[model samples]
Target: MARNVNYGALICCLFVTSIFLGIFVLVPVLVALFAYPSSPSFSIDLFDNQALNMTRTDDSPTNLTIHFDLKLKNENKAIGLHYPDPQIITFSYFPNVSLLTILAEYKLDGFYQGNGKTRHVQGMVVATGFPTVLEGTDMIAFWVDLVGSYKYKKDRTKMHRVELGCLVGIDYISSKKMQSGFIGLVEPGLDSKLKKKPSPDYGYP
Candidate 1:
């Protein structure tokens, strides 16, 4: 009889141990598996120019800044800065937007130039106003500064459609704590180096 009682107790203990394990371990795993995947992205569009300035480049091109105020939509669902996904942000400008500057300068007149006339731009953006959750009806305001170098030449016309395109990495490092936006040019600027009777200082002979 004692042996029978001991066997029954062992069976009960084993069953209770399994139940506790399932509740503490397996259940949490299932929850995490279901909740780890999230969708985090937003849309953006160009608005009007805020401020822009132009100058003649010498041996070394000076860093000029062209400011613009942009409008974003559907920002209520924007994920944290650190999210793993490539977001597409583009900037479409009108004619005569040739002015360029650093995306963000730690010091005054500091910028980076890559390749011929391109620069690797990076900066932080903010969202303003109340956004309609899941409705894609959010309004975002932003100003972007394009930083690069340009050479000053005379009697030359620089006119064409400038398209600037970039991919924003929301979380390049943490995959949960960073966000980025890309910009592209839809219509470029058009200007010339004094076509008729070029200036003696800058006009080409």
Candidate 2:
């Protein structure tokens, strides 16, 4: 007597396995990439539109400490972001219209953002090391760009960026007197200080 091979049962089993894998593995990867991450509004405690606000400029100097508050929203409904410690946040400034110059930088620890949830990442970016000579240009326009990077898990592996980049535009009255006053304010170790600051524990509040 020969053994009976149930073709219908085997087909059903294979079909069920494929569906399970698609729902668990393949589908999630697609959703993660599709949903991605994004920052709707990036607010800092140092600007009024494009002008530097006077809230923390009591020292009458050109450079100031800006408290950055950025909202990171995970669009996926199934994935979470796994941010590591001391993620890099770079700041570049363009004093001249087209001459982009590297400026200061800082870093902050990462936080986990659940699916469809918004988390805040805060850091202090110092506006320093500006050249004293401004070529007597009044109302000089400045362009500042911020690049933030960290690891996020949308799938089995991690991802790098959520969107293109974060940018800020500044157009203010560049007074010679103001620049002259801040000539010697920032010492030689300003950059080191910005880089060596204690890492922030950006955990959930």
Question: Top model by lDDT, which number?
Answer: 2
Cα deviation of 161, candidate 2, in Å: 4.8
For every candidate, C-alpha RMSD to the true structure in Å: 19.2, 12.3
lDDT of 2 by residue, 38-135 (tens): 43222232232224443324466666555455455566565566665545554544344434444455665667767667665556666654422223
Question: How many collisions between residues are there in candidate 2?
Answer: 0
**Cα lDDT of all candidates, in order?**
0.28, 0.46
Lowest lDDT sum, 10 consecutive residues, model 2, at: 180-189
**Model 2's TM-score against the true structure:** 0.47
The most accurate candidate by TM-score is 2
lDDT of 1 by residue, 1-205 (tens): 3444687889999999999988999777756543342221122222222121122235523432323223222112212212112223322111112321112212123222221222232332322111111122121122222222222121342322212232221221232212333243222222121122222333346
Instruction: Give the Å shift of residue 143 in candidate 2.
Output: 4.3
Clashing pairs in 2: none
